[model samples]
Target: MSKIETSILVEAKEPDTETLLVLNDIPLDEQVEGLIRNHKELNITRHRSEKLALSSGPDPTGLKILPASSRQRFEESGIDVSRGYPEVPDRSQIPVFVDQAFAIRNYDLPYTERGKNADKDKKSLFGAATEVINLTKNVGTEIVGLQLENLTDQQKDELALLIAERVVVFFRDQKLSPKTQRKLGEYWGHVEVHPQTPQVPDLPGVTVIWNDYKIKQGMNLNYSNNNLGNWDATKNPAIGNQVWHADLVHERQPAGYTHLHLDAIPGVGGDTIWASGYAAYDKLSDEFKQLLDGKEAVYISAHGYLDRDDPFSGPKKVERVHPIVRTHPATGWKYLFVNRAMTRRIVGFSPVESDLILNYLFDVYEKNADIQVRFKWSNTKTGYGTSAIWDNRIAQHRAVWDHEGKDARHGTRVTSLAEKPYFDPDSKSQRESLGKYLHKWE
Candidate 1:
């Protein structure tokens, strides 16, 4: 017989003669059952016993999927640890919408500033005009009249919270350089690096969300009429502006907010709409809740992999499976967590079943305009600016593409802190309040 593969024994002792049975020669499930029937508890769990001898890979008992070092210990505990375990975020730790908003608004505010340091500081870094405006008892608020191009570190910290609270914030009449725009984004957190865009030389936070032609220095061809397949943002970069998404939700840490400075406006239609997930969940029937209670979704970006300019080719994709109904960590509210832009499937269902459910959810987001509010743009002969901030955890938004030439519409964008998106199922009161502002679908 070939040499047996065994762990090193620290102290040499009499090995069990029965333990030397040709187990490898026989099937493992058979061996386990045999040991169990013999009532040999010690033999039941061998040093390197496979968790599931008949099964193909690692077992899915939640904790085994933790960070690298923990998984190693699980292997030592006689559990199979060969395959990589997927991240399963803690559903119980998700934050509520209003609480998240409050945290963001309060990040850098001074609790007490009455010392020599206080006198030295003329004013807080963020100017008065840039402070976040709380509008209602409901958590929706506005961050008015600030130029994000040159924000202070404190302002960036505060702005990160703002984005985390409101998925997207607005700036009216922003006039700042792209370099500065990129700089402000750095203060918040990691900026997503689009696979297709050409790197901006020394720029760290400025990841290009470019199409094939742009990366190749090709002409600026408008292919806005392309059909969407996988809903990955990189599938069609320009069209990214048209969908509703929490930036890179599949990522371990997703974007808290996206800040746009609207400098350009179409003469006719250039409006963007936002929908509240918290409001949407509150409006659902009890039966619907039962159906979605334990369901999870698979978010994928394979469509981006197919693009020639994409950084990765073939099956190289980014995917995330998250609970469909999640509780916000900060606010303790339950929310419908799927989005048209990233969510792809429902776990435990066949492909057909998953598609059907995902389609239904996507329609819910599209047709239920009541939970959404639309922000329209108007071009003034006199140059001016306008902006709106909406919570991403509980909000969905889409931009309108209708426009005319010679009407000059333009804008700058600065993204802030990409943090792990979370949910809370217990915060029902705030979610209920959102129903009052539901938009009537036309």
Candidate 2:
């Protein structure tokens, strides 16, 4: 082969020890010349490999690469490079992907243009108050700067839709009295007392989700069963919810929304995480989805109430079979309808067959954790006051109890909404993409 002619020279503005070490295999003056000749080829090969990684069909292995320049910056800034990256979708691209998925289910209706008088056409409450701040395009929204102590019925409805849309909604510094909190929950729908939880004597909707430490503080039989007394919700509320699922999916009628009011929060490191079933379903391939249509999975809350040995309690448990694919009642959108905690198996299938299908679905849901949004509690106010509302029908959530004993926290939760979980066969709209409704991702 003939040697290619080129004119390039490496020049160090200021050579450092690391920089010199990198060039140790070659003469410093020729480093740039060598890179110019070879780096472009190396980059092309790497780009091709990364693109192929996306489609080799679901490899469970996790690998991540950070640009050398970015890695160097982290080192210079005293950041921990060894801490590494979690396997997550880059947030910036998520909205685009979700929006694309939603586009598949779009109705043929033409887009309507709202008139300048649109705001005037409707009765105004709070006189032009900004009730919801879209926190992220695909993950979260915060009910802005408003107190839940006394919202109008309309506002409550508005909050419900926001939760349905964002999947998770947050409120801060809310100092509602226990009575006020319970009353607020009433507006959303019927509130249910967790079968194992005890209601505060004065506030019917507010039930304390107890931890072991809380039981020691003179909490009576009203809240603790001798069997479940040592169990902790904060450590693993998913003891029931962890299964890829919607809340109370086993009940004849699943709940609409569940609210958790943080009473006492630790100083640091407690957060709640949620993933979108809507988003998860939206990301599937046509072939993959074809396998799920019309399927039904049996859901049971036995996992949540771990000590199922109380055979004498006459099955104080909830079990039902929900459609493997579900449509959101209000939004009319389809979503994956399995939960890690509640979904047990596919009905009518042999045990081996059920295991294969359910595990695949479970793996898909768990892998999509990248599309989830995590809300870290602010210790300053995560005290006996602040709360959050999540639409359990359309979303799944988990609490992080990593702060055990670091900073003691407690809360009262109220689940509202009488809408039993039902498979809306006719309500499934094609996947709804959120592309246009997004903000910049992290």
CA lDDT of each prediction against the hidden true structure: 0.46, 0.51
Write one digit per residue (lDDT tens) for candidate 1, span 156-203: 555544443444455555444446556555544444443222222334
Say which candidate scores most in lDDT.
2
- lDDT by residue (123-168, candidate 2, tens digit) is 3433444565656556676654567866666656665665666677
What is the lDDT, from 0 to 100, of the residue 363 in candidate 2? 60
Model 1 gets an lDDT of 0.46
RMSD of each: 18.3, 25.3
Q: Worst 10-residue stretch by lDDT in candidate 1? A: 47-56
